[model samples]
Target: MHAMKLSAAILALLLPLGGCKLVPTDKPDAETAAAQTDEARMAAYADENWSTKVLPVIAEHTVDYDTLQKALSAGVETAGNSYGLRPEGEANPWNFVVSGAGTVTEAKLDSRAARMEVDMNGDGKPDVTLQIGPIIRGTALRDAMPFIVFTDFRDQIEFAKLARAMNEKAHAGLDIPEGDVIGKTVSFTGVYTMRSVDDAPEIVPTVIEVDP
Candidate 1:
């Protein structure tokens, strides 16, 4: 009878200890929970703003090289030193200058840099120039209007691969050459921002002249 009583006491002690462990652990602090919720909400808002507000603006004001020069000439100012090309046939008419033939000497999934030799004023000698920037940075002006939210998560990765692939096809199906667009003239326009190359940096357009 005594032994039975001792066993019962031990069982009662263990039961309470087990219950203590199993009790609901403290939940995440209220502040942490609220912060997490806020972060998620902000991300969603940014995505929505990009699709609805930002993209439309970029479409409406697609810029070409000629247009850019005009805007620059006119002294139209912008923050970030960003400039937009006025639409063709607008009140302030702009002209695109086709000086010479341009070729895509290098192409990548995200970025394409090319060189052109053109006679800006019909000179016989070819003047060499370069065009470099993101591959896809604009939408059709008619479809969405002008929206200027530069986000290229994929292009950044592709750009990292551009230098090595300059002479070879970096993408599986796309053919890129070191000196391919040797005799063709291409037209494109985009915002030029300065970047550093070989420790030298300059402001150049993010969009290079491709097709009109």
Candidate 2:
């Protein structure tokens, strides 16, 4: 009887210790790691598609300069959707592309802005002020909603990669054209933003066709 009581007391003490397993939570499993890998691959594919296909299409269909100018005169609320891509609320401080044929009357390659003067008409004054930049700024090319939707980037970093890829490709494409553009007639397409009618944009072309 004494041995039985001693055994019960030992069992009770051991039971509590065994029951308190306190298993530590494991790190992410193989399945979770595989899922993350698949997601990254998806984002990479989308980013490639944007640079190779989407950007070119958007460049091809840029709004004509005169048409855009006329539309902007009417006000962004009225013209925002019709002439250019508009986000949900404000289109101003937004970006859109423009295209036209012009003579490059002025070219300042070494300037901070790398400014250009293109006379779309025969008039003396430049209708379009352009920038061939050391760094391309503005969201006009990046803000194509349909393309952005198609990219389906899950995070800002993925989207930024998409933008940088497109911008670099465009900059490479523009390098020779910017050289040829000076004192030459050319057909060009570019992007700009409008805060108001008074906002002068330094339009920068993603594509430029030089006429021999």
Which has the greatest TM-score?
2
Question: Which lDDT tens digits does candidate 2 get at residues 1-212?
Answer: 99999999999889888667677776677655556654455445545675576566566557887887788888865556675664445523556677888888887776545667888878866777776664566655566544465236567765665555555455666744445456688677777767677776667677776686
Tens-digit lDDT string for candidate 1 (1-212): 99999999999888977656555676677655555543353344345554466334444444544444444553433311344333333343221221222443333323454333333323444422333322322222111212222243135433333222321211122222334453344443322221111211111222334432
Off by over 4 Å in 2: 1-47, 51-53, 56-61, 91-94, 110-115, 149-162, 178-181
RMSD of 1: 11.9
TM-scores of the candidates in the order shown: 0.33, 0.62
User: What local distance difference test score does each model get?
Assistant: 0.34, 0.65
As a TM-score, model 1 comes out at 0.33
lDDT of 1: 0.34
RMSD (Å) of each candidate, 1 decimal: 11.9, 7.7
Give the runs in model 1 whose Cα sits over 4 Å from its true position. Answer: 1-10, 16-55, 76-179, 194-212
Please tell me which predicted candidate would have the highest lDDT against the true structure.
Answer: 2
